[model samples]
Target chain A: MDRLKSRHLQIAMFLLPALLFYAVLLVYPVLRTFFLSLHEWNGFAGSKVEYVAFDNFKLVFEDEIFWKSLKNVMVVMLLSIAIQIPAGLFLALLLNGKWKGIRFFKAAFFMPVIMSATSISLLWKFILYPGDGLVDGLLMKMGLEDSIRAWLADPSINLYTVILICCWQGLGVVMIIFLSGLVSIPDAIKEAALIDGANRRQRLWFVTLPLIREAVAINVILLVIGTLKIFDNIYVLTDGGPNHATDVLGTFLYKEAFRNNRFGMASAIAVVMFLLGFVLTLVANRAMRRESLDG
Target chain B: MTNAKVLRSSFMLVILAILITLTACGGNKGNNSSSSASSPAASSASSEAASEAPKEKVTLRIASAYTPDHTFGPAIAQIIDEFTKQHPEVTVEKEFLPVAELDKKLTADRAANNLPEIFIIFPGAGTADYVKEKKIIDLSEYLNADPDWKDGFISGALDNLKFEGFPGIYAAPIGAYSTGFYYNKELFQQAGVEPPKTWDDLLAVIGKLNAAKITPMAIGASESWRSEHLFTALFYKWNGAEKAKGILSRALPYSSPEVIEPLNKMVQLVEAGAFSKNYIANNYAAEIADFNNGKAAMRYSGSWTVGESTGPNSPAGFGDKVGFFPFPYFADKEEHKDSWMGGVSDSFAVSSRAEGHQKDMAIELVKTLTSTASSKLITEMAHDLTAVKADVDPAKSGKLIAEVSKAMSTGKEFSGDISAFEPYKPANTKLYDLTQAVLLKGITPEKAAKQLDDEVAKSK
Candidate 1:
């Protein structure tokens, strides 16, 4: 009994630091945001904080900009999954072979993933700079001058431009994730598929993709969470501007809290974002799990 | 002993070690915090003693948005160096943050009652907020105590720091600037047009520039503040300074003809394509680049551009060919022609909590920072305009600087950025957004004006 008590005490002691850190860093902030969202605070230290329960959330829901930001985030999420996943999977398959210089190809493809988002956004901004930008110049040289549009300026198309850059930056990570999953699969499985008269496409569909369910699940969750929190790239590229044509929830929350000094309103946005991320992640994981089980 | 007993004893020893470590850390933290808490008071007391005994030390911390790479950085360093040389027993600790970050940090510090001894403050609305909260010390009494120092500041420069409803001057002017057009004479001549002197003249000039295939202006409407700057220029031109201030006091609604008319004229310029191609897509850097590279005829900006344009960094500087003109006035509003937009760029403020020797040191630092010699050095070194009167040598002050100095000096009255004059931060942000929308045709001028009025009313 004495030894059991000692063991339990030892376990508690071992867990205390990590638990304390989690509470202080993560739990405390989340709870504090929720508390703040229920009040009106201008984010100044000496300013009056009034208890205005649900008012901030009500305002957020009523805000057209908030709805616009949500729609933009959803577009990004949908496009990221549609574009990045297939492109990543294709690249993974292409580089999975033991061809010479495959490593170089893989590294080149993965380069953008390692670079900072701010740098990527800046680089792309330069490349897509209007009138004399690389894209316009290339189009003009190709006799496609009519195709050149204000890539980061036009409200109608700037969000899509941002989505394209995001897809480019995100492709490398998804490809690497799929590559790891592919490498871990038993070689015998592919050989068996081959012996069973499976074509390249058939083998990919029947043998390889089924085996990488976990990676797909991870990629989906990561892309969803990433798109929802996308700020730095959009912020750097356009600052959610040309009239906030690219504002995501992250940027909107930042503007509310820091720019407008409405911490309560920003906290309400954050809470909504958190709940949305949590629900979407759960739904994605569950759907992925169900498919895996069916397979 | 048994194995279980030995294990238990070892576990107990590990727990004892951890407890001892935690307690030591806690004790050290307590001592550090307590010492830090008392250090300022102790230093002030020591400085008071040092006046009598002559060997004690005083440390003063100043926070500012001026980084070492900024033009003002070297000027600030010189002032600090001069001050420290005069007072060997004093140390001035500098905390430099970017402007946006500094606003946040200052707000946080004010809440905690832990502001640095001195800090840079935005001249109008930002000063008003700090003054309203009584977080910053009023400088009126100190300025008045020394007649020479009070008179040293340029006429009307200090008034820019004075806010309505605030009883005292909350800040001392450090830098003064005004906004207007910075145009390339070569481009104007290429288009066979002179700098516009009135709204109708501006339209005629724009037509000629467009005919000559020159962008009449470069506006980075993607950055909403650019749109806000244009709005201010138009508003001040048509309505005059008094009516502009009336909007701030809510005596005039934003939706009133005085405000909406300017918004309409701005939209008309957008429709006329006065700005660069895809101007709404361009950022501030792109706008400046267009003007600098001679791709555009004019760039609407502030006096701060003089340093960069004349500096070695400029690839194709116009040198003496650069000319500045205030935004064209309304042809009919000749009475309000002298009303220009722009005033104090930034100011230095002392903390209200600062007392005794610390307060004395802070005030002395401000005086040193804005002294005639220091202001002249800043003017020559940085091509900056200071709030204090400085005799700028035209040979050292480039053509653009000299011209801007003349324009600012001759201006009868200055109203600051209209958006910046709003004490409520959210309304200020909304005004910028509405201006951007209006410029982009996302909303009509009438709608934008109504929205601005609604936002201000709601914020109030």
Candidate 2:
């Protein structure tokens, strides 16, 4: 019993520092945020704060702009999931093959992921400038002047432009992850499929894809979370402008808490965002688990 | 094995205790001076003489919402340098931020009670709120002791600096700005039209410019605030001061016909091809570029644009051609053409939480920066209109600045923008959105007014 107590004490001592840091930084703020969400405070003015439990959440639910922001987030998430996965998989397959200058190709594909998001967003903003921007200039040179339009200004297209930028920046990470997973697949499996007269597409679909399901799942989950919390790109790009056309939960929370000084409302929005993210990830995990079980 | 485990556990516990003690000691060291100096009465008394202490060095942190190289930042820096040179015991450290990030930083700072000794404040109704909350130190005592300092500012500029229902000054004005229509002189000449003196004439010029294949007005509606300014300018002329004041003060519903009329007129102008194609997508900076590059004939902006338009790196062929016109009013009998949209000042207030010599140094710096000599230097450097009446060279004043000054001086009542007077956050953002929606065609003027009513109701 004395030995066991000493062992437990050693483990506790080892864990103490990390636990203390977490309590001070993360756990405390989260509890404070939960408390803040229940009261109305301008965040600055020492105004009388009334506790209206759950009212802020009700207001958020009823706000049309909040719903629009959620919809915009969903559209961005779907686009990233739909386009990034298959494109990343294809690139991963190509990079995994024995080819000349494969190292150069890998570096080139991974370049965007290494660039800062602010720089990338600003670069895209410059490229999409209406008349003299690179995209417009190139289109005009190609006798496509009629096609030139303000890419970031148009409400119909601004969200899509941001999504395209996001996918472009994120493609490198997804590709690298899939490439590692493909490399880990037993060469014997591919060879066996090939020996059975499987073509390129057949071998990829039957052997490589099934084997890399774990990587695919990881990639999807990461992309989903990343897309949901996307702030910098949207903030730098459109600022949720042209009539709040590009607002997302992150930007909305930022505006409310910082710009509007409604800390309670902002915290409520944050709580909702956290809940949504947690619930969606759980649902996705459950679905994936069921798929694995069935397979 | 048990003995070894016991020894390891004892050693680990010792290390943990050491770490906790070190952290505690470090925290105590950090707080020792601050907590002692933080009592309001103590700081208030010490603020005056803290600079005289030769042995104690006090560093004052100033937060500014201007880029370091911008006119405002450098002006403050120059003043701080002069102050520190005289009083070597006091040092000022500045943290420069872009305008977009200022409110966010300020909000976080306020919550943490870590606001800078001196920070920028908007002299709107929100100043009243800050005063009520006692977040900012009252400047009445400081200003009253130095009566000559009051003479340095432009007349009536201090009106906005007064807190609601309070008899004393709560903040100090750093500079002033006014909004008007800036037209390209060359473009106006090329189009064979004079500057429009009335709303009808302006519309006629728009029609002519459209026929000539020129985008009459270049605007950035995407930023929302810039677009909102145009609506405010129109509202000022359309509804007159009394009605506008009533609507802005929430004494009248935004959906009242008085408020909706001007919005509808703005919509009509939109339908009549008054603005550039794809104007809804343009940002304020981009729109300025369009006007400067001769792609668009005119832009509605504040005097701040003068610097960018006439600066050394100004776009090709923009020099000597920019001209100003007070935003025109419709010739209808009811409209007040003499009324203009103008504000007294943009200011900085010392935070109440600042202690020791920091508060004193901050107030001194603000006073020095706003002195006539410094204001002249900054105005000339920034190519901005000077709020204080000074002997600026007519040639140096730039025709646009001269014209705006003339307009403001001659105008009947220089009423503030309703949006400018609103409190920070929800009210201000709602106004910004309403203006943007009008410009973006997301809502008609009637609907825009309705949206304002909805926002007001929700806010209340």
Best by lDDT: 1
RMSD of model 2 against the true structure:
3.7
Which candidate has the top score in TM-score? 2
List the TM values for chain B, per candidate: 0.85, 0.87
The candidate that wins on DockQ is 2
Off by over 4 Å in 1: A1-4, A126-150, A184-189, B1-59, B68-71, B97-114, B164-166, B315-317, B353-358, B405-410
Model 2 interface Cα RMSD in Å = 6.2
- Local lDDT at A252 for model 2: 91
lDDT of 1 by residue, A57-167 (tens): 987997778999999999999999999999999999899999999989999999999999999999998899876789989999999987888898888998999999999
Chain A TM-score of each model, in the order shown? 0.92, 0.93
Score chain A of model 1 by TM-score against the reference chain A.
Answer: 0.92
Per-model CA lDDT versus the true structure: 0.82, 0.77
- Residue B36, model 1: Cα distance from true site in angstroms: 14
